[model samples]
Target: MPDGYSTLHPAMHGMVNIGVRAARRAGEIMVRHLNRLESLEVIEKGRNEFVSAVDRLAEEAVIEVIRDHYPEHAILGEESGASGDHEYQWIIDPLDGTTNYLHGFPVYAVSIAVAQAGTLKHGVVYDPLRQEIFTASRGQGAQLDGRRIRVSKQISLRGALLATGFPYRITASRTDTYLDMLRAVLIETAGVRRLGSAALDLCYVAAGRVDGFWELGLQKWDIAAGTLIIREAGGRISDFNGTDAFIESGDLVAGTPKVYAALSKLLAPYARGL
Candidate 1:
């Protein structure tokens, strides 16, 4: 067990342990595959969306570990899709930045989250390149490699540094709206970053590396773990409509309390008819 594992709620011990182990295993597979990207097979799942052999192998590594310890638990994986329909569902994205990884851009992660009866219980986001793990269990707070972490104290958008992902996969009709929204946010904040990995982007938000993060068209596996970490770290999250429907809608806005409020207000107009 790692140093910080003991600090989480006892009820979450088993899940968190398995989550970390699975994530690490996936991370190892990702690193090993990085050196051989050219020889790996690739597939296009959608316009501007892709998957590589490494993604499947890494997800398999994660799922194998999870099934070993909790064979009956449900799982929702990026590569394999959902299996089982139990109360405890493990949502995982074994390689979050496949495009970046394919291009050797090096910003990706292994994300895993467990939800019991539809409520998030624990999460783990592991960055293989940096060898850092961000973790949280409901009501136990968030941590990075065992030390506690908190959202940034930046209360206003005026100087806040925010992160976001472009909705490349579903941008055909929403391009103008998204660009306008981006323009609004960019003009108000210090700047914005379109990092290749949404999981790492949210983890960065939880660690206060960025004051906030928002994105559209994300899958459950993309934000499940990071959302729990942000909440446990004392940050706030909501759909563009400022509701708790991000999980289903995949349109999310999150930040420290004050920043969340400010950003939500600014983005509300853009979300009016959506």
Candidate 2:
């Protein structure tokens, strides 16, 4: 058993193994497609949003792995949408940073999360470029490449390094509010990073690489895996309202306990009605 797996829920052992397998398979597909980006077929899902042939192929590979091991399990894939509707569902983002991958920015990842009755049970985020795998099972604690990891010991938001994502749509309605929150954080914290991949950003928080992370307009697949990992790593996560509604609202705030509270306080006033 792995270091963190010793404390994992007994029933979750197999599920976590399956998730890691699926994520790794997807990672392989992603890396194989990297060298041939110029010839890959790409589609504009919407303004500033894209889906590539590689994304579909990777998603297919992930689902195939899950189905092979647990044919009855449900799946919610970024490229395929929801399927099966079982008590056990796999949430997948075969390529979390499509734009970054397309640009060969080397910050993308494969994210796989499992949930039972809407409650997250296990998560796996695989970075193909770095060959690092971050895993977490409910109550088991998080791990980076088989070594246990935790959130930064930073006690407060002051001087804490944070990571975030810009709303890609960039609509006029939310622009000012987002910028205001960003400006406030930039002044109060050591610095902020607008990383392209939310899945990896959350993992970085879990691994103590960054003290906190927040983002808007995220799908469940993007944050699901990272959410479990961060919680297991002893970090706190929630929406701007300081509630568990982040998954529904697509507005997230997460950090070490103290940092989370401070950041949430700073961003809440600006998130009214969001």
Task: State the C-alpha lDDT per candidate.
Answer: 0.89, 0.88
lDDT (Cα) of model 2: 0.88
Lowest lDDT 10-mer window, candidate 1? 1-10
- Candidate 1: list runs displaced more than 4 Å: 1-12
Model 2, 237-274: lDDT tens per residue?
99887777888777899999999899988888888845
lDDT of 1 at 5: 56
Candidate 2 off by > 4 Å: 1-12
Using Cα atoms with residue i matched to residue i, what is each candidate's TM-score against the true structure?
A: 0.95, 0.94
Query: Quick one: best lDDT, which candidate?
Result: 1
TM-score of 2: 0.94
Model 1 lDDT per residue over 1-274, tens place:
3535532435446788778888888888888887788899999999888999889999999999999989999999988999997999999999999999999997999999999999999999999888888889999999888779999999999999999998986755576677778999999999999888999999899999999988888889999999999999999999977777899888999999999999999988887756
